[model samples]
Target: MASDHSLLAHLVPKLTRGVEDAVTDALAFILNESKPCRDALVDMVSVGDRRLASVANARTQVVASEGERLDLVAYDTAGSNRLIIESKFWAPLQDGQARRYVGHLADDGLAVLLFVAPEVRHETLWVKIARQFEHPSELKLGSTRQVGNMIVADVVNGDKRIALMGWDTLLAGLTNADSSMDANLQQLHCLALAQDEAAFAPLHAEDLNATVPRRLMAFNRLVDGVASRGAGEGWMTNKGLRAVPGRDGYLRFIGFCDTDGERLIELALYVSLKRWADLGTTPLWLRIWHKQAIDLVDLKHRLAEPGWLPAWSEPNWLWVPIELPLGVEYEDTLDSATAQVKRVRDIVVEMA
Candidate 1:
């Protein structure tokens, strides 16, 4: 088994030793926190390691716990910049968990909920549950039983994504021999504080805001959850799904891996829409890429629309069909695997 130190040694050395230590400590603190402790902990790690060179003249502290007030709170300011962070945990966003959370955040305008759980299923899981409340019962998304420890559902800019780690995964990463503090794991560990619907982007900065309607929020929750759950259960490909919100909040587009072996190596496009192009909404393609497959369908539907046609949206998908050469082990072609992703991106651009 590879030790964390050995794994770190194998990577490129862009991170200064001090910065690396700070980054590692920040990740460690985040993993150990009961809920997301991003605002408080990020600064702590920065300060402890002198990584806050940029914020040398800032005032930072926790929010006052004035009775009936919510969870942990903190504030940071430097010269003209000021930021606030509020931390809290939510039961898995089910049975209207997201609606309640979104409503609360919208009322406040700026709040970050630090989720405490293992592997924040931010992209796929929570969003699926929220989508359930969006459409009528007839057009709603699906659900699954909550498993493992739940993390704080961080909501920033109306973008909702899971924080990924709680105590268990954090502890496991710290103690497990195979878990290394490498760039891949570290990048994966970087908390996607919110799922920006307007741009389908992930936000990590301290100060950012977005607007999300109740139904739209619910839709995002549903879309994210089902796709993530399906992928995890192996009904679909084990890769993360993609989501794209349409213009005017009229629709959302999504896509994922579809793993049905074909007579020849191939890639497929499955699509779903808000109402008109709602075909293929079920997890039937789970055999391919899990719920991510369905999310892809949603994306295709949007791309096929009049105003939101193919060129309107970027060629947002990049997938490659991979097959092991005869007698070639998977590890033997690690470089090739990476090349395959690059090829897929190239193919997508060509198609665009």
Candidate 2:
């Protein structure tokens, strides 16, 4: 038999390090050799006059500074101007990590902080982090306060600026420059896409396993209980309960719980919208257009009720909140989930 310590034990950790290294290497190559890639990155952060070639001057690395390590740091050849980037492939920014990064950069002087993550939603997480700074203010695009290209926020008495860039946006820019890129740079671009796919693949692959089925069973029990009471007589008519494939080919369920075209509700086993999208399914709110029939103010009030947990919503769907049990085996959680589903059903029925 193999010992407790084996080569495979370290494989995942090594792979994670390798992925980060590869990303950093690719970024450095782009900033050095490709002006187009550099310009795109500069545009993302809205660095007014600091072009990547002139300021960065091809000096980029995975930098260690003051007991914290940044994923990639591009500094000028003179070491005066620096662009610090924190890249994420699978993991997210840990608690207080963003705050520390912001504080550190603010004191460092004239630095632009960029955070690159797998999804755009991470941008929201970063924006919330910026709000926690000593002084946070939004840098508007024009007359209206809108976050364009990135959410640019000033921190620490306007000493440092923090910007969020999505991996997709970055990749799109890289893809556009593919025609002019050398063989090595092109290879790096492909590697970045492949890494993203690897990072996101689990969400689709794991859906048919024990966890999803367990959650679906719990959701079905809740739906059945409401139907038995005749509380869902007219609205909860679709009884076919199983995981249905979404646009991304991930197994998600609909028809298990729905409204009479007046409201939208769905229970997703996955944690975030990225995971749902990875599985090829449209979020419930995005699937339907029922805003004309539903009052947004009333919908918000209904969502505030006990047992109803808020999911994503859109202009057309108004509000779609769903009940997700803490654990399927727990009787209390099942009851809570059931009650939540019942409450939403009642609200829709009343609206109808």
Candidate 3:
């Protein structure tokens, strides 16, 4: 588990993509500035190949001999770039990105192309990346562990190698090499750890067992029950129009109606995880765009009350919130969920 007070954890949402770029920069700095850290990384990556042994210094955002922009390059004593490290986070692999990076290393005669990413991707992401290497599709495709569960794939064409390493594997190597690493490296470790935690871990045996299905089935029952009540009130569901994304097992919020005025007024019970992840946020709310508010100042003033508060969104929107307290029992939570939705509905009714 990551620390509750990790600085990287806090800044991640605010910085958004800047954090990923900053992490790559921080890694390049640590590799160049700290010899112990750099040497340890090289030693770990080198393993049996011994080709990457000469890699001495690291640089960030180097353009390849080819036109592609490489993330990090590890240099050799002879000034030849022997290794390419691709830093990744929550982003899909670009078309031919892996193949192109490895191609850059292949030109060096002896090199390694390493991808450092969150550990959770071991099963999901690596397979997709592995497909990039196929020429009419390679017969042998899929990431494998050759260097202590770090190397994602081991491909040998003459004297070149392709490897995939988890952030955990790389950070552990740095720590194992020097227990008291530099402050920057320590911070990097914390940030990577926090990132993995936030990304959520791969499911284990407990998740695959019988206990989870019953709970999910019960939750589905709740959705069915609530949906039935909402349907009876003549709210348009638009269920067949479009499917919700990332919604788990009937977890999608019902699109109850179309319009309150010129635009639609979304008064529904939901957990807003919009990019910033309002996971533990208020359960009941009305989502209205800024344009929907004919007089923004007046609307803000009108919605200011004890049980309701209006919060603005970026680009253009406001969230009128009301807390929906829930309990473990299905009956109680069902009643609570229904009442909260009705309360939001009544508020919208008054506004109309």
Computed on alpha carbons, the lDDT of every model, listed in order, comes to: 0.32, 0.51, 0.62
lDDT of 2 by residue, 1-352 (tens): 1111223222433566566666676677667777666666665665554333334444444445566766666665566446778776666557666666655443444567777765635645655555444343232211112255555555534556677766667766665765576554445545554455556433445666799767545444544454444334444333453545443333333332345443244432222334343333322221323534445557567667554444344444433534444435556654654455456556755654
Q: After superposition, how far is residue 330 of candidate 3 from its true place, in Å?
A: 12
lDDT of 1 by residue, 45-86 (tens): 231112221211212232232322223222223232222222
Candidate 1: what lDDT? 0.32
TM-score of each: 0.21, 0.45, 0.55
Best by TM-score: 3
| Count of backbone clashes, every candidate in sequence | 51, 6, 2
Candidate 3: tens digits of C-alpha lDDT, residues 299-346 = 556666666544444446555554545556777777866665555544
Prediction 2 global C-alpha lDDT: 0.51
- Ranking the candidates on lDDT from highest down gives 3, 2, 1
Sorted by TM-score (best first), the order is: 3, 2, 1
Give the top-scoring candidate (lDDT). Answer: 3
Pick by TM-score: 1 or 3, better one: 3
